[model samples]
Target chain A: MHVKKLRKNTFFSLKGVMLAGIGSLALSAGANAGTVRVTVAEYSAKTGPYFEQVAKDFEAANPGIKIQFEVVPWDNLLQKLTTDISANANADLSIIGTRWLVDFVEQGIAEPLDSYLTPEVKGRFIETFLTPSVMNGKTYGLPIAASARAMYYNKDLFQKAGISEPPKTWAELEANAKKITALGNGVYGFGLQGKEVETDVYFYYGMWSFGGDIVKDGKSGLDSKAAIEAASLYKRLIDEGATQPGVTSYAREDVQNLFKQGKVGMMMTAPFLANQIRDEAPNLKYGVAPIPKGPSGDQGTYGVTDSVIMFQNSKNKAEAFKFLDFLFQPKQRIKFTVNEGFLPVTKAEAEDKYFAENADLKVFTSLLPIARFAPVIAGWEEVADVTTSALQRIYLGNGQIEPTLKDAASKANAILKK
Target chain B: MTAKRVVAPYVLILPSFVLAALIVIWPVNELAQIASHSVNRFGQLRDFVGMANFRALLDDPNFIASLWRTGIWTLGVVGGAIICSVPVALVLNEDFYGRDLARVIVMLPWAVSLTMTAIVWRWALSGESGMLNSALIEFGIIDSNIQWLAEASTAFPMQILIGILVTIPFTVTIILGGLSSIPDDLYEAAALEGAGRWEQFRHITLPLIAPFLNIALVLNTIYVFNSFPIIWAMTQGGPANSTDILVTYLYKVGFRLGKLGEASAVSLVMFGILLIFTLIYVRLTTARGARA
Candidate 1:
């Protein structure tokens, strides 16, 4: 008797669910609407409502399309996307780091948006912001957020150290750092990031300023004279006790935290540091300047961008493109750029008067022209890891910088060749 | 009826047999295939490279260095764990006040997540703003702070200590279980013979707990050999790969570098090494079992 009753209930529930699904489908057909799912990494909790509000507005205007929003934390975004793609369960549109564009293209996982991009939409993006998304003459994604590195110094500390201006060159920067270190407080002159998550970029900031490249003509560039000089400068700063004592264990976040606490005199970071300072340390006085020039007056910093990618396996491409269009509208893009404190990827947003009037963001915008991105290639992360280890060796070990960098370059070349 | 009896038993164990095949046998077979082929970043197998991936490791200096370092790491963690566990296990097994509480306290580190342990230790050992440095300075043990994880020499020792901290709880619990199984009457009878406490422990307790120690030794060796998070979280095998072990290196090569073929080769090599160790260990212990 119990088995019969259970079987009858299961049959009725199955029928009811099927009827409900069909009823919703028919009702959606009457409205001629479809759902497009989108995922974005939450820049901060404060910005969560911006995405939901935009999605609601898009659905209201489009009438025929519903939007599904997935907001994930930054740390979990990459893993979630990779797993989704592997399982063929990706959203129609998603935010992905520009670094992964090449990998996505090589793997045939990202949909090439060149054909989908209207000429008007294509012209809206800053050309440089689109560079990392291009592989083999085809663009696979659109830049949604951008960053350019700059040197932020504690103005109060500089004044106390009797410095009238920010350092203009590498030598001057080191001298300034030393002077600040002698201030006799628990303050460190420079906050160095020596741990994971772009420790190599710190080395590259100096390397690029010194006009050195990691790869030249598909081979290692560590043996170059410029590379040696860059490595030497960092080593000297660390050895002279101008930087924080535990550099080899500090990640970018740690350095940022130190800067926020007024424990650091200077840090080379993105403009987002301004937002952090505004939110966490409103009273701290600071100044932003382009990264110090090398002996020859060459200066550059890494330009990083995050892009919105359409997945290859997405079934609702048409609806996804519609939402993408809505999201990139000048009105929406400007609000996002202002809210997120990221550099504008779109020309309209870039030309907006709001960014120009914002003093903190203006400093970063001025440096954007001189920003240099790391080589977008397969196995680039491995090269970065090797560079990080090599930098650690130079800073911590008794090894000479030239040989150490040379060894690292060769190791990087081996991975690139493979 | 006789034929039905055998078939019915096989039917009963069929689900577990399939599970074992899927979980263990299938992955090992896949690993074998992956080790022989060159794979792209997207996990697509591209070419049949035969033993080229394995041959590449013969010339790769990083792999060689990591292999040697992994041996030292395993020995340090396992040896330290044994040294730490024996005393704690003995103390916990004794009749004392709050013995149950002490046992739980001894096992608390094991219950805590490895990542949490790593984070706590990393903060404690931080050079400029660490509790350890502050305490040492206050007591005049050192005049200045030491960058424990920034230098190769110190980071290596710190990595081993973190490993021991995480492994000791498991080791102590296992040894404690062994200690409890010893009949109290044996010690009491020895006491009646005028045997001292030390003599009773040496003759009765030691002999009975030897098997448990062997178990702890083998298990700790395997656990320490495969351990990844504590070292990865703390140092990421940094300070010029001075603290790198095989598993962390494999993760770097596989996930970061996207060299699945080579990573598979590294995994197979690690597996082979551990398998050999386990076989020899089991043979020696089982032989001792037969003798006993």
Candidate 2:
């Protein structure tokens, strides 16, 4: 009797579980009609609250249309999207690094927005910022965030080192760094970032100034004479103690921190650092300037953008597009740009006083014309990794510039072939 | 035996067997499938290519270097932890004032998340404005601050040291449990026989705790071999992939480089290596039991 009762109990419990699962599935199916899920990359602490408020306001404006958001960190966004897509359970919309859009489009995971992007809506975006997300004559994504790099210098350090202005050329920068080093009380000049994301971009500032392209005529320009000279110049800076010690240990953030503490004379970074300084080190007087030009007067800066893309598999495409339309409005763009310290992506946002009159943002906007985006190619991340590794080897004095770069070029070429 | 009796054990174990297959076997089989195929960045499978993914990994110099480093990382952490834990466990097992406090302090690190611990270490080991450097300078230990994460030489060793530190608490706990299981009369007998402290440890405590030591060794080797956060949070196996172990390399390949096929292949290799180690360990232990 006891055994029979136990069997009956197990049977009823299993049936109950199945019923509950089916009921939840039915509920989700019903909810899916009006719900649009968006996976947003968390840019800062304010990113979540800002987006949540937007979603609330959007839902209020359009009754019966709910906006659900899954906020992921910047570092884990790609991983999350990959897993989500592989399982065929991705959100209706997502924010991805502009560089990764090529992969998304190649896999047919991104929905082209050309049909929904009317001329009036399209005219709102800066052409330069919008160009990266447009591929094969179709807009697969919209520029949600954009930033360009510029040189930041410590005014106090410059004054103490007997310099009246920021250096205008690499040669002058080196001399100025030496001067700052001489005034050392644990101070360094030319905060060189040798690690982490965009390490290749850091080297590219010099490479471009020396008139080398990342990829010239379908081959890697890493082994070009220009690249070699750039590497050599950076190495000389390290050997002379003009940059921070153990440069391979200092990522972009680390160098920025040193600049914030007023220990570093100069560092080239994104405009976000200006915002960071305002909050974290308000007393540190700083100046923004163009990246130092090469001997021949060539100059370049790295422009980065993150895009919010519509997934091809989205069930609620109309609802998602509606939300996106609301999001790209000047009002929404201004709030996002100001809160995140991103440069203005829309025309109206650019004309706003917060951006138009800002001295630091002026430097960044001026450089956008010469700014270079990461090349749109399959396996670009792999190419960037190769470049970063080769640069690291050069930075650590582990490999010679010529051979190390040559080896890295061949490796990059092989990847580019694929 | 009756037919019902013969089938009862299998019937009783069927549910757990199905669950195990679902959780473990299913995913591994799927991974094997992905490993043998050409997978895109999003893990969509393409043409089947037998042994090609594995061959590609073997050809990559970075992959080979990471494999060997992973071996060193596992051996260093496991060996260091065992050697350090034995003395610590013995000391903690002794009757002393504040023994509970000492044990808690020793075990405190294990209570924190591994990633959190690693992040704290990253800040403390920073080249400039780091707590470690300031403390060293304050003590006049060196004329200048050392860049701990600058290269593989210093960075890798410090990573190993941290791995050992985190592994100690768990290891010492296991060994302490082993120590308590040993009857006090054995030590008493050894002492009566004019055995010194060393002899008591060697003849009585050591042999008795051999099983526990073996267990700790196996578990620690598995944990340390697959450890990701410490190295990742520190150097990210960077400065030219010098400090990279297989797991970090797998992450780079799978996520960073978007080579899912090669990444799956690398994981299978790791699985194979661990499987072999566990098999050999089980064989040795069973053979020793038979011999005794």
Candidate 3:
């Protein structure tokens, strides 16, 4: 790998701090270790087993270290976190969504961990996790998991239609969808999330693989042929028999149900669904693929850096660093992430004997090289709003591409400046 | 009793007032302050943009559409709910072999969470595999399964339709309770006047229950207008912003977009609209009562 030269030199290198404090701060939570309470958005009632396992393992290794867990919802996750942080009552540990890292950095809710992490810890994970969380030349958190979206397909449906493999390009994907739909019995050939929020952003990025993007530099990327073509491609599947009829009404769980029930032939979904399908619908044969290439040849898939950052106001940075040390090792990281459906950050962990045995996970692991996150700007949440609204109008059959995309870009650029 | 009431009353209410300040009043004042600024993803309130957030919403085409859509939804769902509920309540109030059973069935939607109800209906109304659409096609009412929640044209109506199911239960119970309070004497007096059932309802029954009906109307209208979960879990105001109401739109701005000020402003607009409608309703109803 090439190390790009810095345009300007900073005298304080992160590498310098790690070596200086390795012994003083490397305190793992043990007999003398302090408890670090953490909060997270709940995934399931079964989450207890995973958390218990992680706590038991970390505690056994670190001696007296412990974890306190509180789970909320995706909708209220940020608000709850902020309320705690705003009140100076934030958790010692937090399992925050990757999308939120930038906003936290801006508010000074997170501590700059450059003063704490060892170079060994930094080198162990995918470099992208650190890059997105880094700002103004400082690292905020060590990521526990990296999530990316992929197209999941039912292998049985494809084989029955005489299709031996999943499509590699947008055109072939559409064509295969049509064939699968032709097989009939009211089966849809494709599924994609049209829900509002970050989920909607993923669908747009998937389309960007064919040459559509919501932003280009400081301008609208959605008005071009690529974006319009991408929009039309989705419309075609809806109009054709390739996708669930009411896909527009689908939330993440709704799509999950359809895919699990053998209703949808192809779907753009999270990597975790692969794990879920194994438990809920193990009889179903499935394969995962990268979001196909568009005319631009730059395929699109969203990666998440599920990171843990210290609240700036916390009075317990010493204990927090101890928790970070116990958390970073892949053994606990893999247990927390894989059970939660997140991909491991380290290449070795992604190819761990456990995840390696899961065929569908192998597909997600394969696509990690091309994964990119949405632009992590403070106003990005607002950009997603404008983009999702515009996409909704397009789907309604009344919206035009150029006007909407231009408006979106203009608004986004202002956000970028802020 | 009145001799020692003054200081005693003040002491009695002090704790309640303190709790109110801690819960409702504090949050409300805080909301007003927060509503004044565009907060970032973190909780810091940004520059004082004044009412620009509210003004921006006025200019937002999507907000305007949601405002109108909410008006239609409130009126349609509340209106349909009353229209269907009153008659059913009246019937269930009458002598019948299975009246108790029917009333129990009517109260079921109220038993389940609105979110749960929306989920169940979404599945039954799903386009291809939905039990409702599939059954309709099976019965030969339509050639193929229609996407009830998928297409733009049908999305709002479908939401209203599902909303009606959950709404009817509440409206019916309110009216039913009102119905039980009405003495049979009013109907007997109307019968002597050669009045039929419709005539009695127009004259005797309605006028007697007008107070209850109006209360039900205001409550249901407000509830339906501000409702978020039903449409969210079902259509999420989607298939192209078709099912968006003021609340979901505000949520999009406030929570999802992290434009808390704009969301709060939108929420204030929603409150303003409801307040106006409520005042108008009270004035009209009271005027009619005075005349009577």
Which candidate leads the pack in TM-score?
Answer: 2
Per-residue alpha-carbon lDDT of candidate 3 for residues A15-75, written as tens digits (9 for 90 to 100): 2222323311332222133676666555544555666666777677776656666554444
Model 2 per-residue lDDT at A119 = 94
- The i-RMS of candidate 2 is 10.9
lDDT of 3 at B126: 73
Model 3 Cα shift for residue A171 (angstroms): 2.5
Better of 2 and 3 by lDDT: 2
Q: For candidate 3, write residues B137-204 as lDDT tens digits.
A: 88899997776776657778878877887899888888888888989887898899899988988887
List model 1 lDDT by residue over B1-292, tens digit each. Answer: 9999979999999999999999877978888888899877545678899999999887877799999999999999999999888888999888999998988887888887676677677778877777989999999999988888887689888889889888988999889889999988998889899999889878888888888999999988988899876787677677667778998888777756667789889999998998899999989988988997
For each candidate, what is the lDDT?
0.80, 0.89, 0.71
Error of 1 at A107 (Å): 3.1
Clashing pairs in 1: none
Q: Indicate the docking level reached by candidate 2.
A: acceptable
- Give the TM-score of chain A in candidate 3: 0.85
Clashing pairs in 3: A29-A65, A30-A64, A31-A64, A189-A242, A190-A242, A209-A294, A210-A294
lDDT of 1 at A264: 82
TM-score for the A chain of candidate 2:
0.93
Q: Tens digits of per-residue lDDT for model 1 on A174-212?
A: 998899888966788888888866888888888877887
- Candidate 3, which CAPRI tier? acceptable
